[model samples]
Target: MGSALVTLGGAESVVIERSRVKTLLALGGCVLFVVGSVAIWRAESPVIGILGLVTFGVFGAYILHALFRSGPGLVVDDEGFTDQSSAGAVGRVLWADVTELGTWSHQGANVLVVGLRNPEDYVARLSAVSRRYARVNLSMMGTPVTIASTGLKTDYDSLFALMNERLERSRLRLDSNPPRT
Candidate 1:
């Protein structure tokens, strides 16, 4: 686990890279998906077998991607935050559009959900499965940007504090300088 304050894209950024735990968990998921795929292949129901194959194909791709993934999983700068932690994450969320920040439990995993001013637009941009999850998050968690802390090297509370502080700063800056008409 490591962290660094570095300049990214001409901005000073706090980069929190993913931990080995995340890599291990991803590998574990790959193994489970493989096993499930094999089990489903042997099942008498053809429909079930096909479903398993689909699951394997989807999760298998994610597993392979995770294996090769590198660099900071999360990056916080003056403008906004970029999330590469979750599969098919929104990529980035500007501090200006961030409406709320809170935590929720999804499948026993603690996630930080960032509410946006216009979640629908972002949700529409996601892939089918990611869009589905985003919708579920909206209905269940009240947000479209749900970030799992499991992948991050930084502690969730500290990260939350940093984000909140930055959000406040962004708001203050905007308030102080209204856009010229």
Candidate 2:
């Protein structure tokens, strides 16, 4: 659907674009959501019906927008990583602040958990809505910033490998030259 990795400015900068196939799949889900919303409305379930209608309506609208949207889902550079791959993703996590990086699965979806030196500072950058979601992620995954591989153009293995390699190099560079006070 899209290139897995795009090197910008030699091999120093790279961007992982979202998959068109994933976007189509999301669009299909939106259609199902609309259908379910209508079915719920007709089944005399007012409370659940209203919730379904509103929830599905908002999600469907966002999916439609995602279909046409195309950009770097994840950006990795010498500085750090910018995760735009997940819903309410964090913008930047500098290499200096990243202490650990790993992945886990929840509800059949793979989640990438990036351990930060100051997690609270990153959590504070989120908007009101994103902050709410981040709290749930923090509770479930123990890290507010988690990337899921579902909508990404690159597969989980490839993304993880690239990230690990870059992180190692960053750590080595940081270790060799301590920051000036």
Candidate 3:
């Protein structure tokens, strides 16, 4: 076999990132939202107060959920990377199928990319993170492939190690193939 890394499956692919900073920001926002909502409720405008409460609930849920799930240690399995995969859970690409491994800074962070023959499957998997249905994993003119980042985890080394190991194991095309445009 090729290089092997002990892949451990868990609640998250990797450890939680330093979400404390983000959590503080979100918690601050949630507190403001709750306060604003309560203020509205007491302002003699029941309608506005109700709307504020609803808004508060939405903001609270989003911030809380993001805080809890925003862990570090994102990993790739036999199928695909954890929770990050749009298609399913695990995603594995045959070496022959991948065009290249691209490194690009997305939203201020470096990401690992794997190009594919048809991006439909990959696009579908990233729908939740994409704003539009037609804009999942895309460059300019539309291409099939995927880009997974370490997000805020900042563990590029570990992520790359796993990815490279997985690719070698899968036998994806490498320098032998032509590069991308």
Higher-scoring candidate on lDDT, 1 or 2: 1
Off by over 4 Å in 3: 1-73, 78-80, 83-97, 106-108, 125-136, 141-154, 172-181
| Model 1, C-alpha of 86: deviation from truth (Å) | 1.1
Q: Largest lDDT belongs to which candidate?
A: 1
Q: List the residue pairs that clash in candidate 1.
A: none
From the highest lDDT down, the ranking of the candidates is 1, 2, 3
Per-residue lDDT tens digits of candidate 3, residues 31-126?
Answer: 787788788789778788778778777656645555555333244444444333222212334455555566667566665666666666655654
TM-score of 1: 0.74
lDDT of 2 by residue, 89-177 (tens): 77898988888889897666666788888887888998886687678778877778787666677777777777788899998998899
- Per-model RMSD to reference: 3.6, 3.1, 8.9
Q: What is the lDDT of residue 115 in candidate 1?
A: 85
Residue 69 shift from truth in candidate 1, angstroms = 2.8
Identify the runs in model 2 with alpha carbons over 4 angstroms from their true place: 1-11, 37-70
Error of 3 at 31 (Å): 15
Residue-wise lDDT of candidate 1 within 1-181, one digit each (tens)?
Answer: 3568898678888888877676677667767866777777787766777687687667667555655677678898899998887665777889889997887765766678798999898889888977876787789877778876666787677777878888888899999999999
Which is the better candidate, 1 or 3, if ranked by lDDT? Answer: 1
Error of model 2, residue 67, in angstroms: 4.2
Evaluate model 3: give its lDDT: 0.51
lDDT of each: 0.78, 0.76, 0.51
Give the least accurate 10-residue stretch of model 2, judged by summed lDDT: 1-10
